[model samples]
Target: MNQSSTPQVPFWAHLLCGWPLFLVAVGGAVGGGLGGLAYGISISIFKTNVPMPVKIIAPVFIGMAAVVLYFVIAVAIFTAIQ
Candidate 1:
């Protein structure tokens, strides 16, 4: 019996291999952002003291940050697996 070693691919290859996972991460970010935005808008509309613009903007920033964090985490996990 003969066995050959598996080929070593680049980091980008690893990322591509995990594309579905990446998509999930993106979905999570979008869902979180939309939820936060909705909550913020609701609060702004219903509450008297809070500013509407801040409410709308903060969630967008948070959402972008969350997406970045998700990518970092996904890369870390992929690296660990490798």
Candidate 2:
């Protein structure tokens, strides 16, 4: 018995080549997951241990960063596959 030699598909091949709508959903999930994680960590960790000014500003900045991160990651994934 013999087997034909074909290059193995990369693990991410489907992710990079699947339906466009599916990719968008995946990207949004990943970005939202990470962004929410970051925000949660910031709120939990910096809630009470920080100085007054830091307490007021850190969460806001972290939240903004999370939003930016979400958008950036989503855009990057969508663009990369394009």
Candidate 3:
């Protein structure tokens, strides 16, 4: 039996760098998932009592943040690599 040692990959490194389209797609999926989760939690507790603005804004912001994060991370990684 032979044993080899290698450091485990960090979560941030694993996620933040990849093919451009794939990264963006991942961001969209993650954003959608987060938005759904937030909605579920909010409705469960608030039961339509949550304000109209809050419901509409939360998902939009989360989605936008995911897109921005994808670009920012890609640029940062590209700069660091070069």
Candidate 4:
């Protein structure tokens, strides 16, 4: 087929290839930051006994888990669409 006449890859192809990774990276960063912020605020406001490192690390780990969950969901949806 001529290059111009060839069918372009569907939008979903790009989404399937890239969107989950992007979302996870973004979600992890956001979740980590928010988690740290919330921990800091709670510690200052409520005087929680949790350690600073735990507060900072918990969110990052949770965020990573969330990203994995998100990927699974996305894959399911993508499969259904196909």
The Cα RMSD of model 2 versus the native structure comes to 17.3
Candidate 3 ranges beyond 4 A from true positions? 1-49
How well does each candidate superpose onto the true structure, as a TM-score?
Answer: 0.44, 0.52, 0.41, 0.42
Looking at model 2, the pairs that clash are none
lDDT digits (tens) for residues 19-82 of candidate 4: 2244534446654444444433433332334665664455445445556666676678779999
Q: Which stretches of candidate 2 lie over 4 Å from their true place?
A: 1-28
Counted clashes in each candidate structure: 0, 0, 0, 0
Report the error of model 2 at residue 73, Å. 0.9
The C-alpha stretches of model 1 lying farther than 4 A from their native spots are 1-48
Query: Model 2 over residues 1-82: C-alpha lDDT tens digits?
Result: 8765643434343222222323235456765565556555555544345575774556556655666676787688789999
6 Cα displacement, candidate 2 (Å): 57
User: Taking the tens digit of each residue's C-alpha lDDT, what string does model 3 give over 1-82?
Assistant: 8654533434432222211234324556654454445444433333344575764455445445545765676688779999
Which candidate tops TM-score?
2
Give per-residue CA lDDT, model 1, range 6-63, as digits (tens).
4333454333222233334355754455444544443333334446575445544544
Estimate candidate 2's alpha-carbon lDDT, on a 0 to 1 scale: 0.53
Of candidate 1, the 10-residue stretch with the lowest lDDT total is 13-22
- Model 2's TM-score against the true structure: 0.52
Would you list the C-alpha lDDT of every candidate in the order shown? 0.48, 0.53, 0.46, 0.47
